[model samples]
Target: MALPCAREVFTSIFKTGAVTKKFCGQLKQLGKVCNDAFVKKTLEDPIYKNLSESAIAKKSRKTWNTCASVIDISPSSSA
Candidate 1:
């Protein structure tokens, strides 16, 4: 999981001295960008291709059901 984009952003923040020891507010944008870029890049990776396929297959194999709905007896609901 060597994300170059994320590493670059971190380096920039650290070099600018905008980041502090305790507070990491500078990471807000970096976090968002890294998350978006990582997802995009990970999907494009060859390893993710087969992995995603298998994961999807496993997900599709599972069955899910929603609970039955119950009728409301309140006067507002009746109206």
Candidate 2:
């Protein structure tokens, strides 16, 4: 995924926003390894250092699974 798409996905997971379908497709293309690494890096950010690592990880997994299901259910589309 591109930087913007990664940022968008991070924001969507950490904050209150919906990720665009186009970005979801990009994420699906990138697969879970990239997603896991991205989330792991985010866990190291000082801003989130005070938060529970396990909770953030659990949420990340949930978000990834949700996005995967969404992308699987729909045909790919442009942003």
Candidate 3:
């Protein structure tokens, strides 16, 4: 879901030719782009996110770990 369109969002956010991290962060604060299903799952699911991680590869476990940390440390912004 959201992962599929992450590149698109990234490109859209960087269209101004400004690739700075701060610039990209600022653009993310702008309008809507895609459906919220996956985003909601990442934000609302259990901390372990077993069901969600079932779809991901074992080699990518670190990805989930980082996502969980973001959710734990910054629940308000994780969404």
Strongest candidate by TM-score? 2
What TM-score against the true fold does each predicted structure earn?
Answer: 0.28, 0.74, 0.23
What do the candidate models score in CA lDDT, each in turn?
0.31, 0.73, 0.33
What's model 1's overall lDDT?
A: 0.31
- Of 1 and 3, the candidate ahead on lDDT is 3
Candidate 1 matches the true fold with a TM-score of: 0.28
**Total clashing residue pairs per candidate?**
0, 0, 0
Regions of model 1 farther than 4 Å from truth: 1-29, 51-79
Q: Give stretches of model 3 more than 4 Å off.
A: 3-58, 73-79
Instruction: Give candidates' CA RMSD values in order.
Output: 17.1, 6.3, 11.3
TM-score (C-alpha) between model 2 and the true structure: 0.74
Better candidate number, 2 or 3, judged by lDDT: 2
In candidate 2, position 43 carries an lDDT of 79
Displacement of residue 47 (Cα, Å) in model 2 is 2.8
Estimate candidate 3's alpha-carbon lDDT, on a 0 to 1 scale.
0.33
